[model samples]
Target: MALISPFLPPGTINNVPQPVLTAKTLSLRPWTAGDTPVVFAAHKDPAIALWHRRRIEGLEESQAVIAQWAGQWEKESGASWAVCDGKGLVVGRAALSRINLFEGDGEVGYWTLPTARGRGIASQAVTALREWAFDAVGLKRLQLTHSTRNKASCRIAAKTGFAFEGIKRSALRHEDGWHDMHLHAAVSATPSG
Candidate 1:
């Protein structure tokens, strides 16, 4: 009789892995309904209102945006995430949209709660998301738009390795007048691990 192996274990199955991302004391994860309160407050913050699109007036509007984001994520064509602090409180949002799959391009957008500003959180979040976009999403280029007067966002773009492309005339209609938008881009065609 042939000798049998002593207690050979059978192959075990592996469960699907959970998506994870980190940035200093902050973490990035897909947006969810639970983030509505934070989202509402952030939208109403004066700093965000100065350069952002129309303010989300209430919880209902916030919830609608969340639903839209969820649908976009399900389509696997666009993405947005809530930025959470060490305490796991959603402090803001970061998004990559207008995804052009054929060209491997997308636009990056972000905002931070007023209390979280000046902490380098936006810069850190953008950098982390840029890496994820290039590596996980196989994107070749990422773009950003900054209002000419929004010095903070322009600074963040520079700090995050995005090169200033140029300015687009009448890119946005603000309270004053049509605002020129500064374009910034990062081309990740070079191999990155």
Candidate 2:
């Protein structure tokens, strides 16, 4: 057997600072300690906590999480951005995790503040993140998965061009129990006409 060469060379993402991405009404920027309040509040929202299956106990923990998100860029394992509205209010989050540079693939995830829901914030942020993952980061594919019951996430995946692949049986565990997950994916290539 022969060793497979990496699709994207090491340092493709970690070599430079993560760039801020913009959508029509959103800006996805690196997370920082200044976002502690919003992060803490978002984690406490019932809807967010239910879907994300975690809670921030305090501002200190939120700040630590923000710092960890920032550090992931240097580690090249993942990246996260705070999705801000035009006036600079943090409304959501967008991220790429489980990045495998060798395979040029990663997983995508996002969540919007309860107050910011139904305004297309998640869709816009995911779109921007997808573009950056493929074009700038040189990823070949991005996968998105959400609980089958998460209709909003399903819609966001569709709107962001992640084609539905299939369902994974009891793939993720939440507070209630394991839940079936819908898997969606988008590749960086377009068919030639």
Candidate 3:
């Protein structure tokens, strides 16, 4: 029998897996107090602010953000992993957000520290999250969206096997202005490989 069906329950997100998903170069795991410095540094990068449209103002806020990241799993609204390198230093982040359990859908997003770019870190982190979302968490559909201008993000989504869906005109409001977004998605019914 198939694992996924259209008749999933509304609180299916209660099953969000908290396992540490390991990739070839990354260990996607829960956030901790020690990750505060890395989180602060990543958000301080202007490019991250430009793309994500949110920035951590100070150490306190960074702590709060880590706390919030931890709380997301319990709330069943989202789950985020600290993308750490072999040394256990957080080089990036990956998250499944906007989770709708009744609909079995979630949105995936990620950001890498400036030092980690061009190393394929973001794509690997995303791939790990995608696998857990489908195979472990039982999420049926995962969507990824990025600004049309974000070429790197687009590439990461494609590299992770998220098929291009379409463009959402003025889909998001960033500090600069309203911007169009490119939508991509993956469904659990299909084999990623």
Candidate 4:
């Protein structure tokens, strides 16, 4: 039996610099150490803390997280971007995690700062990341999962053209308990428009 070839080559993502993607009102750029304060503050929001289930704790931890995000790019394991508004204020984060080059797939995750909520920042950031993942990085599919109780994330997934797949029963655990998650997905062949 012949072994299957990888859908994307190993250097597909790591060969070039992680790009800065721009939407009409938002820009998604690689996270930097200087953004540590923004990241630390964003995690202080109760909603973000509840949904993401991790805290920055302090400036030091935030800087470490940023370093980890950058290292992931070099390792070809993941990519993370800091979402900024038109005026260059860091407002959120968007990322592709669990990237599998052989499978041409990755998982999408994002969160917006409290002030940026209800402004579609997450949707725009996710849309930009989706395009980069599919077109530039050569990923064939992307999956996004959110806690069932996170109606906002569900809306973002739908608005960004990630079709509703189904629920993953008790898929993740948070401070409260295990939560059912809604899984949404998008494929490269399908236009997000």
List ranges where model 1 is wrong by over 4 Å. 1-18, 191-193
lDDT string, candidate 3, 1-193, tens digits: 9566443465565554577999988899999898888888888899999999999999899999999987878788899999999999888999999887767789999999898899999999999999988987677899999999999999998999999999999999998999999999988984422
How far is 193's C-alpha from truth in model 1 (Å)? Answer: 17
Cα displacement (Å) at residue 187, model 1: 0.6
Candidate 4 — which residues are off by over 4 angstroms? Answer: 190-193
Report, for every candidate in turn, its global Cα lDDT versus the true structure: 0.80, 0.92, 0.88, 0.91
| lDDT string, candidate 4, 1-193, tens digits | 6488888879988898998999879999999888999999998899999999998799999999999999999989999999999899898999999999988899999998888799888888999999989887778899999999999989999999999999999999999999999999999994432
lDDT of 3: 0.88
Cα displacement (angstroms), candidate 1, residue 77, comes to: 3.4
lDDT ranking, best first: 2, 4, 3, 1
Worst 10 residues of 1 by lDDT: 6-15
> What does candidate 1's lDDT look like per residue over 42-129, in tens digits?
8888778778766998999999988887766655456788888999988778888877665567899999987788999999889988
All-Cα superposition RMSD per candidate: 10.9, 2.2, 3.9, 2.5
CA displacement after TM-score superposition, residue 172 of candidate 3 (Å) = 0.7
lDDT at position 63, candidate 1: 95
Q: Give the Cα-based TM-score of candidate 3 against the true structure.
A: 0.91
